[model samples]
Target: MPQDTIPNPILRGFNPDPSIVRVGDDYYIATSTFEWFPGVQIHQSRDLVNWRLLTRPLTRPSQLNMLGAPDGCGVWAPCLTHANDRFWLIYTDVKRYGRTTVGGASGASLRDFHNYLVTADAIEGPWSDPVHLNSSGFDPSLFHDDDGRKWLLNQLWDHRPGRNRFAGIVAQQYDPAAQALVGERRNIFPGTALGLTEAPHLYKRDGWYHLITAEGGTGFGHAVTMARSRTLEGPYEPHPDGPVLTARDRPHAALQRAGHADLVETPDGRTWMAYLCGRPLPNRGRCVLGRETAIQPMAWGEDGWLRTRDGSGDPELAPPSPGLQPAPWPAGLEWEDFDGLDLPIDFQWLRSPFPDELFSLVARPGWLRLFGRESIGSTFRQALVARRQQAFCYSARTVMDFAPAHFQQAAGLVCYYGASKFHYLFVSRDDEHGRHLRVMSALPDSPQADAFTAPIPLPDDGLVHLRVEVDYERLRFAFSLDGEAWTWLPEMFDASILSDEATAPGAPAFTGAFVGMACQDTSGTGLPADFDGFGYVERAYAAKVG
Candidate 1:
């Protein structure tokens, strides 16, 4: 990897809403994970130019149980900090959102955005189970004052009719001894005219309490808004200019949807920012890889306000290093043989924290055995294990041996986004088509479109090779009886559809695209499929593989 790529997405693929903290010479950033379980994604860095995936603290069923949690509603913005010689983490678990209902009546306007706090002695923990906080709204952060008082800040939700649902940012005192919030909650910043105020992070600098927030929603118009108050409470003045950092005016910039930022200072008294950004695909302008975490240089102005190093207010594609020794992690493998007893660290499964029910590395010795649980579109359990689509041009290949005796059972590969949006290539048996390979897609625009291509009949060997190549907006799949010869599926699917922007107007589309193995048995039988191995080669690092 070249140093020129330093500033562009220090953490790539589905890592969003970054909350960065500095403890000593080490820096850690916590990003929202949404429905992809194992909760929040945390990465550590010695130099802002290089970052390594650290640990996902929310592991066990007790800390996070997203069995039925809707898409884009699992884990929201998380704030990470170090105080009292321990790591403090605040997060929001949204059970229900948008206009859609969850296990309730259709068209119901109910929402559940529960907030919690967890403490860990080390970044990679045996972390304590989460302590429930208020559910007033989402995007919660705990600010530890210099005087030893702790205050909690979050955006209050106003679901009342004729009112802006985003309301404003609020703050309240939190008592650590009682493990609860004390004092009355007060609205600190009503936000600017940008609207949709959320994702609050507070800082105390000089003689002021500075508030940093994400406003104008999380789309292309997203921005980082800053405000400061002389006291802990009362009136806080917004920055004289508009957003401190945004790409709204520069539509052609390499990074889009840049907002939700956090700041950290080095031992040398220099400041750097960790923020979330997206790279939309050409032609379609959809960010299929989802929002990623990036770093930029920040300098304080003589006016007592923070601005980008260049003062352009736009995210830079190439940024300067944080002046620390670069301790880059060794490159990971491109092909996984599935011979190990545990799943690869780079891969994660969806919901159902208990992995025994969905997959096993020991079930079939040197294979990943997936027990068909439900349809791929089921909100509950589905036998799908995947990794993030980190690059716009990458190829994912897998070999599966499945004997689907009934039409209800299917096992193969999937390029997935959500329940209602994905492109799947699987092997199944039907009364008419017998055992065959088919390409099915659930398009975002057409909810009722559970359409499939013409089935290609196959022998009863149950051994097949599958691969999908993605080049920008085009997605093509191929298959083989032997691992040597490959045959294209003859259709160029639109890879751009698997994006947050592709979802409906007000729907929650917080997650990025994932490509991996999946199995489904709609017949109520736990049929099993064995996958020998998996390979993902991104063009950016293609030299490491082939």
Candidate 2:
């Protein structure tokens, strides 16, 4: 009998740069959050198909930067590992371009790149405060050798003698017990013989120490390359043919620019790879979901070299195996009804340096209250919004009722990136006007610019449903006083700015552009927005699916 088949994109939306580790029958995965708070997100899955958020790895104010928007900054690709009866996560804290500091600057100041370590006895933590590693480089990954030696693999600027280059890969011994660099760092691999490389992940299997790095930049040309060595310290040999996975040759492949992958073996002994990829709309390259997580099957070739099943190295839209049974669809927690003691695994916040007091999971009964603060630009910085971007096309509907005590208390649904790139469809009451629904937009580097406001007038019934429908490249928004009789909003904004090429650039960054629906009450009056009846439907329309 033929095995049961499931649709392509077992997990959809904005989940990208998936790092998977198996602990017994349970599987855990984490992904990149560029400028989003609660930096690294942890996910738990019984089957590889169904996943739930475990907990955020970074919770302390000292660990994150909540008040500033780190453009193409925040947490990049993170690797999760289980060792010696504990869980260890080593990740990069990317400082935005202009936000970094040269000397002793303050307030959204850019600092040197650094890798931090966090550990917990349980996946659901109480994670320890971040232990800062090297003060330079990005995309830091941790590996444990068979001899029980720990190594840190990272991509740093190649500021050698006269070569003014931006990319290089290095490895050094890491003393996890000491939480510091143990030995001299070695330049294992630089950019490709022809191009640049970043987001290097190291793994050892079958006596080969595999150095998997992303190359060709993070745009449409992104790719994954592999070099292997018998000894961890010796010269590594690049795959004879070149990149093991890429979409360069297959320019028209449905999933474009696949790279930054982590490999794992299922309990059933099947090998699978999870990476970030994006789907570009016609005539546009901006990704709404940004770079998204995708999975592909892996197999050892006749020569014992690992290769993607599709041969192009791009993320395939099909299952990893033909005979594997499809798992049931995972249920998502409703944002309005989220009254649990902890935040759901699917809900991820933006780049917040202090996530603990930035928002509360149980601050109120049946409400996730985010107190507005003036640190970040507007309330965009302090808003506690959670997003699940696992599907290409979806509809997020929410009922936001907030009585702003002050002019700064604007509350509603938002599609947020950093302080610069975000769109919001929300309702706020002015001192003069009762309540009005408005739409706002912010571009990165631009502060509170290009905001076109249209007041949504509702009936006296005191209920309005705001819905945003994403159809590939086009995003259509509608508001209804009642569930039926929807009135489409005339203003439609082009959403290609979310693409990794358009956003991060350079590295083969996980371009899983997340199209999430989040809620926030940014009015600084210390009053919270009362939101209720939040619902999201994945792939609401089959037409023009990404």
Candidate 3:
């Protein structure tokens, strides 16, 4: 993986709070698709060492619905940009958070999070429908000035009562011909002291207006804070050297919760940045493949600040080629015969944006039915589709057909990460194991995780193939039937409890692991499950692949 070098998450698994832009030689980035669905994950790179997956612009339901939205809560941190010629974006849905923050009784910390805004002259779209913008907080930004003026910014959530509930970063004046937000909102940047400041991102350079934030609270003491201000309204200053990037003192760094950054520039002026990393699992512990998107290289100090071009604030496993001419992109599809009718922009589903009421492809044209619904930790509806485990040793497989006549009906294969974390395996029946295949699990344990495991009959069956491998924190499960021999499942599991540090002690794991296909039928009756294709590869995370 080298052509002068460049390979630091250029965008990997669960993608997180990135937010990049370029528009001229094309470079986009966007990220953060919390509860999954069609929210935002733009991608598209020309030679920042190749990338590709150009669209997911909140594909309709009046632009994002999220049915019950909860499982890290729908889309947060979007912002993508370009200007006048159009391409703006901005996001944040998050409705309600964990339950009782610790012992409960805090103030201004219940977090509901809203915030919108859209635009598109073309990044692939007729896109242009949301423009709400402001539920008071949750990583939002706009900024577009040079006198054409436009500004917004966010992270102003201060629910009072000894305040500190991430109450910093604010701004205003954005009236793109009255699309709204005009004048006085100020409070510019009060970060530093390593508080939990949110992700702001503004930048002016020469006359200096800088800003860029994300402090110690995305887990494991994350960072990235920077500040400046020559008067875009601010008394800003911090960065006489403090977090311009951080690995929280690099605990043996391989990228871990490394802050939220965003900055571009590379016409020949060279200044990169991208941010949002995390790769943990052994020793530094738990990340399961969430928070990804890295890109390094930054340097601008003649006392103008902005470090890490090797000033070593950590996070740069290979950064060096911005010199272009290395466009590599070809490797996707080893299996997924759901035979088209749409479903394979690498898959995603959950929090229903009405995925045909949960799965369908002309009913079974090539198979991928699902139907079932409700129970896989249902925040509302649940058929679960999934995709994105992005390797650390991977393997997935599928085949299903399902015949669960009872036991309240169930379907198959899952790995998941929310609804308290997951495991699943399924087939179900039970008039005393009439059909059988079981394995349930939901881990956050004692912190609350449910369990089931103990069935295994299966013979009146013809399809059911399933498989899962995962090596990084170990996960097993396997089965076959007439597909040709395989059986594992001697119980290995704890794939790091799916992960975002073990499905968060009580919330805010911001998504990661996920293996596909699920159904369920609390017995309301729908019951169906077809599947027939879905295969994933990627196990060779450095060495082990049979």
Quick one: best lDDT, which candidate? 1
Model 1 alpha-carbon miss at residue 481, Å: 1.4
The lDDT of model 3 is 0.83
Whichever of 1 and 3 has more TM-score, that candidate is 1
Q: All candidates: CA RMSD in angstroms? A: 2.8, 4.8, 20.2
Error of 3 at 509 (Å): 16
Q: What value does the lDDT take at residue 290 in candidate 3? A: 82
List residue ranges in candidate 1 displaced over 4 A.
1-5, 100-109, 446-448, 540-546
lDDT of 3 at 163: 72
lDDT of each: 0.89, 0.65, 0.83
lDDT of 2 by residue, 1-546 (tens): 333432444445556677888898777888876666667767666566655666676767877764553456667778898888999888877664442333342222333577888888988877888888886677788888778998888877643434424457888998877888888988887666646677777787778888888888666777888888887765888887687777776866777768878888886667777777776666675566667666767877767578877565556766634353443345655444656666555566665555544456566666556655443334345654646545556777776555554345566666655545566776656656556677777654244455756676544336666777766556667787766777778876655554444443222233344433343344434665555546776765443312
Query: TM-score of predicted model 1?
Result: 0.96
- Give lDDT for model 2: 0.65
Candidate 3 local lDDT, 1-546, one digit each (tens) = 347878788888889888898888889898888777888889888788789887798878887888886678888889888887989888888887766343356644566888888998998887888988668888888989899898889887776656788879989887877788886888878798989899898989899899899999887789888889898888898888789888896788888888988999988887898989888887438888988888977999888898997687888878778777766778788698988899888888876677888888889798889899898878778998988897778888888988878888888999988787888898888787689897888888445458787888888567889888888887888888865688877887787777787754566778798899899898788888999898898857543322
Ranking the candidates on lDDT from highest down gives: 1, 3, 2
